[model samples]
Target: MSLYSALYSGVSGLTAYSSALSAISDNITNVNTVGYKGTSTEFSTLVTESQTFARYSAGGVRAIPRTLVSRQGLLQSSSSPTDLSIDGAGFFVVRNSPSATAEGAVQFTRAGSFRPDAEGYLRNTSGNYLLGFPLQVDGSVTNTGNVTDLVPIRITELTGTAEATENIRIRANLQSSDPLIPSVVAGTYDVTNAANNVATGGVVPNFSRDIEVFDAQGGTHTLSVSFVKTATPNRWAVEVYAKPASDITTGAGLTAGQISRGTIAFNSDGSLDVANTTPALLDPLNIAWTNGASSSQISLNLGSDSNVDGLTQFDSVSTVISTSVDGAVFGNVTGVSIDRSGVVTTLFDNGLTRDVFKLPVATFQNPDGLTRLQGNAYGVSDFSGRYALVDAGTGGGGTISPSTLEASTVDLAAEFTNLITTQRAFSASTKVITTVDEILAELNQVI
Candidate 1:
């Protein structure tokens, strides 16, 4: 019986020690594996009586070891535009929904090896869609409270297309006592003597201008505007006409119906005061020209408003003030820049511009607790907690680079060392079995 008890004790030791050695070996093998954490065994005696004092044999094996948490490794940067890596905290959310369901298909990961999917969505290498709020140009995410489904990155050519038209604003002071019947003249006015015609009761002798605007089909339209001295210095007439092409000869002929006319007036002080009558043909026509596609020319004659009582004197006026017709045409996209707040602005090819969108980032509570899916990604789980939304360059999340990537984290030397230890431990366990066999043989001989 004593021999049997000794044999059982040896067997237990051999089995427990062998299991411990296996745990160590596993740790060593995976030491070099990315995102892998090493593990060790914890041995607890079996439930049984000790045979040394009462002749009863000890029974049962010890406890086994398991891996608990994987340590967060250092992040290596590849600087690739698509490669993203977290520096301080938070895990990237991923979805493995083969059917792309809203709630059920979910996972998470720390790896940033992401690419575009079939639908042009930013997905991981494993075809898993990444989860996050859509980044806007302003570096702020839209509807940040809600989480977006797995999707691939959609990168359109940052290049955008644009068209532009310029509305030339012209304001001129025409004198009230010139023999001109019209207050405003819009057309090629063959000014007999523009240099000497400078007259006024507050009206300049002559003022003329030409503006360019784009048609619906992107064709260029030219508008000719002119202000001539009428019969009265304080009452000058206005005229407007449209030419389809840059060369006045190539443009459509201006008809009386297509023509616009108005009047300009002045005060006793010789300073020009402008007001147009309600029936002025150019007032409505100019509105249509600036707002309409084909009708290019528009003229407004500002007749004088008579309520004057102050020391209003005028000497030589060079600039005219325009109260109506305020609009512009964009050229094309030429430049792009983002501010710290994430506001995206685009300069047009024609010197025109506008704001596009805003961009933002997200954070999680227990990033390590996230569930890993395919393609080095992770999804939110009960353990991982909720997402904390933030703008780009805010908190710990860094700004996104236009062209960059992130590398992996693995240790090779540590794995090899663990492998040797496991090998020796395995050999020692085998010797224990052999030694027990020899003891049994000796006991038989003694018997």
Candidate 2:
């Protein structure tokens, strides 16, 4: 009976060693796989009860394959900007289809060799589509902690964009030595129309400057701000009007291309005096574009109170210095970039960047317990706890390394050493099987 048990034990040894060899073979083959986790076979003894020490029951061996999914892999630079990697814990949530919303279809992976597909959806080589939270125009993301809230990151819809000018600041020196012209009204100056600007029969401004501003439609328009010395000391009447006169429909209190008319007062020290400045700086000037654009508002910012940073008045010759305006013309989408926090920003040729989506990193209680799936992905199992979606580099999640990929966890030297040991063990198991066979054959002959 003991001999019979020994024979069965030898068979178990052969099976266990075969399993170990298989695992080693796979490890050696997948040494270069991106985001690959190596699996190893662990052996355990299966013992049987024996009534007495003299009568010993041979024990068998069992092999268990364990995938080291949690072990981090080395990060390497990648040529593709969409290629992403996590430096620490968690995986990238992905799906099979861009339109998939089912919770069962959700999967997780560390393989970040992603690129935009034909439809502009980001997908990895494994055929799994990358999912992310859609960013609103205000740069806010609303996540319900559910897979349905995630969508495929498609960039093709963002073909082109235009930004309207909202704020403008002018910096220049107004001639303080210019004498107050009696012909120009002192207390209040009304620009009958922009035609008063020409040298013929109209009043010529002492100084004038032109600035370009972008409209809602990305159309460029030039605005001229003309200044005239007034009867009041240290005060000048200013009028802001658009060029070509026909570009904008005239509104009330606006004529001759004038959008706004106000008087600027300067302190005796050559600094701006805001309290005495009429019409207040930063007030929205509403205008209707004749070029079929919607009504838009533009805010003007003169300098701070008693600050010469903007609209300075000095004895120097008057000249237009510089202008700072926020806007961009219509532009084509150039490319996309991802920040360390996993925010995907769409870049345009007009030097504008818009946040498109935010990639979420998923974490689990037992990452090693995940079930291996196709495309270098993993599925949630009972052993692995429920997944939680977290912003990259937040809530203890791993920081996203843009334009990089994670190297496989396998080590060639180590795998080769394991391969040799497994081969030897497997050979020894064959010897055990053959010896048991010989013993059985002897018994058969004796019987």
Q: Whose lDDT is greatest here? A: 2
Steric collisions counted per model:
71, 2
Task: TM-score for candidate 1, please give it.
Answer: 0.50
In model 2, which residue pairs have backbone atoms overlapping below 3 Å? 193-256, 194-256
Candidate 2, which segments miss by more than 4 Å at Cα? 101-104, 179-190, 193-201, 280-282
lDDT tens string, model 2, 372-410?
Answer: 998789999999889999888887789999999999998
Per-model C-alpha lDDT, please? 0.48, 0.85
Q: Using Cα atoms with residue i matched to residue i, what is each candidate's TM-score against the true structure?
A: 0.50, 0.94
- lDDT score, candidate 2: 0.85
- In angstroms, give how far residue 199 of model 1 lies from its true place: 22
- In candidate 1, what residue range of length 10 has the lowest lDDT sum? 193-202
Q: Model 1 shows how many backbone clashes?
A: 71
